[model samples]
Target chain A: MTKKQLKNLALQSYTKDLLDQKKVESVARLLTRFQLKQYIRELRNSESQKTINIVLPHLPAKTDQQMLSRLFAGKRIIYHVDKTLLLGIKIIDNDQVYDLNLKDTLDNLFTFVSSGYD
Target chain B: MIDSQKIIEQLENRLMSFGVDKKTQNMGVVEKITDGVVIASGLSKCFMGEIVAFGNGNYGTVLNLDEDTVSIILLGKEGKLKEGDGIKRTGKLLSIDVADTILGRVIDPLGSPLDARPKIKGARAMPLERIAAGVVEREPVNTPLKTGLKAIDAIIPIGRGQRELIIGDRGLGKTAIAIDTIINQRVSNDVICVYVAIGQKQSTIAQIIDRLKEEQALPYTVVVVASSSDPASLQYLAPYAGCAIAEYFMEKGKDALVIYDDLTKHAWAYRQLSLVLRRPAGREAYPGDIFYLHSRLLERAVKLNKKHKGGSITALPIIETQANDISAYIPTNVISITDGQIYLEPDLFYSGIRPAVNVGRSVSRVGGAAQTSAIKSVSGKLRLELAQYRELAVFAQFGSELDATTMALLERGKRTTEILKQLQYQPLKESLQILSIWSVTNGFLDDIPVESTQRFEKEYHEFVSSRNPKLLETLETGEKPSEPTVTQMEKITREFKKIFSF
Candidate 1:
């Protein structure tokens, strides 16, 4: 498989179980083979551009009013309620990132696995 | 063959461009000139580099400083200095580059990579400054940082974000424990580890790199090395550079661990530079700020509050005590600065405590909160039993033992000693398994004879191995052993004791 195909496969495998089966099938049908190929190509090219755009997850149990206010605050950022990113919001632009989530920092700190005395 | 006259004329022209009031201290004493660098010394060593450009006033940054007397850092091109010439300095020291990327990768004290990898890849660099963490921002350590070694984890618990000093004589596995901690981080990829080698052998550093590579632990680990062969200036900055690298991760709200393999050499290196810089010396000819030097470095290893993303920098500052004297200046200063200490005893090491950690006095002031429930439950009893055993064993050596309880305590002590005597280089996971097994085995501790307890403990381990392999699996992952698992271990130990009645 091509690199694009592999990346799509990996992404699909990671996110597939999260979506409802019918929704996944519908989403898959929305993108034809040619569109899928184009999407893959765009993702691959964007990966090499040294710039990234990331959507941040909303705070847990945010009120609808608060959500609407944040969405239309004239800022070029948006928050979606994706539980997979844990409890934080991350915005990636250019080569910099703005992380407003507690989970990311906790995750990074907890990732160390060495076992000797320090 | 360049003429001295031409060289002097070029020098005069360069000096004139700098607007310097040239006194022409001595003229017409034509000296043979070689390369661009000039070296002439009558009263004192003088070095002159080609004048690259003119600076403000009579003082300007030259292209090159005198090669013999002063080393100059040059910027841009147009400069002239002959092989045999003299240049006067404005009594300024050259500046060196310092950065956060200097951590993890094996680099000379001068910030040059010794591993031959590409240069450091950080965007920001800073000068080495001695700064301490602020009082209001500093918090008491409460989180336990497990080392996977029972002796250390149970007795001398190291807390997350604590500065724990490991003090021992040379060749007592001080660096081994530090390296093992770094390697153990592989089990939890969330922990970023940095190992700083100060005044260590280059080949020794190379071996450490090889070991890390073998374990595939290098990706998340950084090695900062300052060998004895490196210039004193580099040694002086080694620990600061290591801390800076750790700070990069900490500021980003990540937990980072840095190990200063030993600080004795770093102190000596700083002393050398201090003397060179004309700083006054104190006890042992070290600068008066020697204590402050270490305190500031260690204080930087802090745990930020939850509001600031709750990052932590845990420092393992190793110190080598001369002849086991902990009261020495360096040792005492480090002991007071760190959160706790792991005191390695030569006698215990000879008695086969692989880590040689003297449990009687070594402690982690705040690490008790971080231990697993199972460890906390058993560790208190274990320490008490071991202490009693030591006291009794000493009396028994003089043929004074007379009671069944004393004999039982001695037996339990032997078994505990054997269990704690882990083999060298046993990965953290294995050590944890062995420790947990010893902790939960109550049957083995109850009736075993003091003389044959070591043998019984060995047999008990063999018996458990034959009965259940999952015990090892759970320990390898650092997961708490389930109640059922503990019950199974207890049952197995009981059955083994019944089957192999002494």
Candidate 2:
């Protein structure tokens, strides 16, 4: 999602929490506790290092964490197994994406090769 | 006939021979897009003036390198460039291809073919911005660059490598003078001409091209047009591009002439680009670097020394003034940068003086040294006589009675001014110009009426050409007139005077 879309989603959830807060006193207390936890998580997210969201063909073992950290130092790593990735990895940083998947790489290579003749 | 199978086979072989290498590229995201300017972030490695590419494959030139973002001026159409589109550095500064084939062609600032003809081939790329030749590499201006106008050739002669500013209000024949100069180059065998039209109307450019075509000067001239419809970036780049093309020939040890037809619009375009890029504006809302911009461009006109093949570039930069305000910021900046100025006056233009050159204001500092001796011998006395006549004519106008000498001076001045009035696009040869000026300064035209001076000049030139062609040849070969030549000219002038009736 874009930064703008993410901000809009946060505003919608806040409105939902606000409506739930006025329902019942017991439920309102429980909602306040949950809101506090959500606020803390947001603060942590803002203060933590930028996250690098990665998509791979399959989930790797936990033993690969050290190697992944070595490759992307000082960056928080999150993984998602995408079946369509086929054989390689796709890493998305803040404003740039590293397309290392077989399909995307082949597509880029075809374009790079064909554009020369034209 | 061409074979499609063989072409396909060659293409396949080429594609197989090419290997893809994985290299990390510095990337950025467009933060904003406004008025052909793109503000992007994460392009920290991009240098100033570097060429960059957008996601849509269009290109831009980096103008502003900020802390986190860079400002790029788009060189092409602004369509399909989104706020979050990807940007990548091309690692190249702005440059254009220049070659001999560019002559007789009309091109945009980026060297694109605007004439709708076939694309030029064998062009070598030259950077738009370059350092000018240093003082040690240059020699003093010692050869004349004639404009074919009698008044200018007499008083305000331009040297081969001098920068002469043509300043005047609009409709005062500024461009006419430049076009005449270019047309005059037809007689000069070695001079290459480049005309850069910046921010002018499309119709006006078309008319100029049509005129050039009519004159048959297109074979030796290159026209660079960045009209009012072009983006400000292209307008700002036009003069520099023209200079680079001229410099290409200059590097090959050839004489070249480049004309910036009115830099006022070029300044306005630069101001627009600077404001859009958010640079700090100075006096007149122009950026502080405005002076430097023109200085660097004009400084490129130089006369190289012997070791550099004796090539030179003469610059004639036209600046249009509002209400004849030469003290305005742009005019003064350019006047100080150029060697001298040819100030054209609207009043003179209205008075039927076609060239309309204001003698007192127009001066050429470096031209005297390069003037031909035959012209120099006659022009010096003519200027003094004209200046004196102008001063005394105002005094003589207050009273009907005057001395014979004062009457003679006024008559001479009137006739001299009439002689200097020349039509556009008909550049007189140096021999003919010298012959005309020599006759008047030597009192041969004193008996001729003021109204009859133009007729007398035409008859005298034709008589000399038809009767004694060797005299004109001698003058052309840079020989000053001896007693016999003067006697021969006088004999013919007396005969023409008898037959010439007012």
Clashes (N, CA, C under 3 Å) per candidate: 30, 0
Query: Against the true structure, what is each candidate's TM-score?
Result: 0.62, 0.86
Tens-digit lDDT string for candidate 1 (B58-171): 112222222112332222121443333333333233222334555446665445567777666434544345365566666666666767676887777777798889999988
| CAPRI docking class of candidate 1 | incorrect
Instruction: Chain A TM-score per model, please list them.
Output: 0.32, 0.49
Which digits, one per residue and each the tens of the lDDT, describe model 2 over residues B397-486?
Answer: 698789899888888888888889998899999999998998888788888888788888888888889988988888887667788977
All models: lDDT? 0.63, 0.85
What would you estimate as the lDDT of candidate 1? 0.63
Error of 1 at B432 (Å): 4.1
TM-score of chain B of 1: 0.75
DockQ, structure candidate 2: 0.16
Query: Cα RMSD (Å) between model 2 and the true structure?
Result: 6.4
